[model samples]
Target: MVKWIVKFRNERSHLWAKVVMAIHSGGRSFTTIPIKNSISGVWKNIVQLGKGSSLKLSDVQNRLEVKMGCGDKIFFWLDKWVGDYSLKDRFPDLFAVQTDKFCLVQQRYSLTNGEIVWSWGGESPATHTDMAETWAECVKLLEGVKIEKKSDMWLWKQEDKQEVFKVSDLRSELDGMDLIPET
Candidate 1:
């Protein structure tokens, strides 16, 4: 189930991925969409697996890492495109004050007169020292990350050399796991 979702994320241009996105997520990001009760078959099963009491959505997300390029597809705060974790997780205080939580990385910054101009979504009040410090740290991290013309890539965190997705590996992993807990 995690493998399917991971494959969908990594191969957004693939026909199967496109069909799943259109039918399951309604052309929206798979991460943001809610799984409906009416949903059936593979999509429903995958969604249910991710939403299981024991298997969290973060558990699946944590398996993939993003390398931001054009930054259009990568969620600015939600995606683990920069650093070890998402900015929302790393800077909780700033995330709480963020106006647009779903804003893309490209939306946060612009190229103007050959310089990168950052336009933050919300104002961080000066009185909150924690938020202010967090905001500065987040900005400092962003400064070093240059948005380029290349397409963004999502690599499997478990893979050492390539961004390849193998169903056999996932099958072996599942075969070793105890899916049901003895209550």
Candidate 2:
């Protein structure tokens, strides 16, 4: 139920398409003929439009606006694992001994362009002996550099320069916190 705004780089287009198709198709549970047919129909439409005609990450906010109508629930898929780093830091006494293997982490983030960005880190979580260095490296890569902030909103720059991403309606109490967990 955790939502994500996925953004895929050009090289990862195939994965992006698969995920979108999965979303529209109800992932692994769509089996009714009508649902299947509807999904197939949508896929055909997308395919006919071609990649160039397809939506970009920049279109996601507007697209969500349309699709969600007045609903407050946002939808997204997580292709990676994420951990509660804040919890780990805040209650080290409670979480310190929990192995990385037990910590769940989110794998994907949605960019404004409608693409999914994969986490850039090692596949496995950092071991107990290497947790500090691993966590530092992951934070360095995922933390956005603050660019501007107002009373109600803040603009931050992602590590990827080619894609300019911003976060509005700041809500840290929500899960994910605009960061990808390093596994």
Candidate 3:
């Protein structure tokens, strides 16, 4: 049997919760034990393990590695594939960790299928307008858009319209608005 500890901290409350799971290599499952308090630093088996059998340390570590790896994969997929446009545009406070390079705000239309696109700020109005129309058409056709990052360009779904617009263009629009700051 092996022991593995997982800890989570609440940023707002500053509270911590720790879970200790014991795994048995032979059984391929965790031991049912309640790790109520950390002060004692003892492993008390809360569940019966068939009359005297307990988990070994090696088993616990293996289980922990497997679980942690699975968690990391899921997190990677969510960050790479999902786009929360409203949150990206309106509530930076809510998602403090999302970066502009990784995500985009949901647009009015969804991109069903298209190639990725990129645009920098301060492009000509004709170019910007064309890009915007293309993007809007993409949204209309695909129903969703995903902004993907590459070494030199951002990729996104779009239609073959004469016009095209990018996130940088949208930022320019926002800047032009000159919205008042909240007091």
Give TM per candidate: 0.66, 0.23, 0.16
On lDDT, the leading prediction is 1
Q: Across residues 1-183, which tens digit of lDDT does each residue of candidate 1 receive?
A: 767776666566689766765676532232533244565877778867767645477666776667778886677877777777778888877776776776778788889898887676776553467666667778888888878888777665554654555777666766877978779
Q: Which stretches of model 1 miss by more than 4 angstroms?
A: 7-44, 50-57, 123-133, 172-183
| Per-candidate clashes, comma-separated | 0, 26, 26
Candidate achieving higher lDDT, 2 or 3: 2
In model 2, the worst 10-residue window by lDDT is 72-81
RMSD of each: 5.2, 17.5, 23.3
Give model 3's TM-score versus the native structure: 0.16
lDDT for 31 (candidate 2):
19
Off by over 4 Å in 3: 1-99, 104-127, 144-183
Report lDDT (CA) for all predictions: 0.69, 0.31, 0.28
Query: Sorted on TM-score, highest at the top, how do the candidates line up?
Result: 1, 2, 3
